[model samples]
Target chain A: SQKIEQNSEALNIQEGKTATLTCNYTNYSPAYLQWYRQDPGRGPVFLLLIRENEKEKRKERLKVTFDTTLKQSLFHITASQPADSATYLCALGHRDDKIIFGKGTRLHILP
Target chain B: DTAVSQTPKYLVTQMGNDKSIKCEQNLGHDTMYWYKQDSKKFLKIMFSYNNKELIINETVPNRFSPKSPDKAHLNLHINSLELGDSAVYFCASSQDLRAISYEQYFGPGTRLTVT
Candidate 1:
């Protein structure tokens, strides 16, 4: 069976600081990895997707790094703002399989 | 316009009853999906439809069925809902199943509560 894990504890950082979240997987070689943002009582919104061949991807203040050798992906939000507080999820997917999501890491930005 | 939408945003029903959640996507996507988020906030895929054809069905019970009238619509029908069935159901769609860059757009989600 394949399993994905993220930090279970809530990550708190001051505004304008960089916040890094980790996603680790075991027993699966995904073709692509994705990150999503989810607010309370709302569906997840796609943030970024990185292919197995790609090393890193960026969008605005968000950046995602994929290290297939380590079976991990790191999501970083630079100069974070209070409005950026939300749970971030990492997803793994192959060509023939549906995307699988991790439990997610809750990030809180303190002013 | 809302790219993806689901009807009956909030559903509260008793155990043993039956209900359905309707989903529609205006993005003209060829792949549609149904996902369930549990109390623990774990998101899991229940079903996936491509061009109105069933492509992926997870280890979901037979009590849960997904119907697609077309490429842009997918509806979920649950029979004999149990207390454990309470969760938020989300509908999503993507451009095509074979496209590697296909990114899913999600709806607001339907919160189902079985008392």
Candidate 2:
């Protein structure tokens, strides 16, 4: 069966530290992978997208690495702040319009 | 200005009732989608429409129906709501489906509670 799993249900990181979240999948060759950030009582907001051909993507204090061979993607937040605390979601998409999302990992940036 | 918006941010109703959630996007995107996020926080695509045409329909129940009046609006109607139907419904849109999987902008989401 095809499945997508995040590293954990919750993660705790100190402020100004680096936080790493992992997403792994089985038996799916997705053309692109996406990361989304959702806050409490809010819908998910798009963060980053990495194609299978691309190894890494970055935006400001955020970075994403994609390894199709390993079927895993890593989302990193450097110099994390309290505002960065949110549920991070991993999604896989193919040629078609459908995308499968994994259960999100909630991150807490403790001050 | 809100790019994507859904009506009635919170809805509470009884079982066996019928309800509708309306969504509209002003981003000028041609493709729209409806997603359901359960208590487990797993987001699943229920239906997708591109330019008023149904493009993707997942293994959703027959009680759930999606309507696209035009390219800018997509509405979800659920008949005979049950306890399992209680979840957060989100509406999202992208620029175009032909693109290399563009990012989606989501609405504020509607939280449906069934009693």
The CAPRI classification for model 1 reads as medium
RMSD of candidate 2 to the true fold? 0.9
Against the hidden reference, what TM-scores do the models get? 0.98, 0.98
Off by over 4 Å in 2: none
Chain B TM-score, model 2, reads 0.98
Output the worst ten-in-a-row residue range by lDDT, candidate 1 chain B: B95-104
**What is the number of residue pairs that collide in model 1?**
0
Colliding residue pairs in candidate 1:
none
Expressed as tens digits, the lDDT of each residue in A1-104 for candidate 1 is 99999966589999999999999999999999999999998889999999999999999999999999999999999999999999999999988678999999
lDDT of 1 at B76: 98
TM-score of candidate 1 against the unseen true structure: 0.98
In angstroms, the error of model 1 at B48 is 0.3
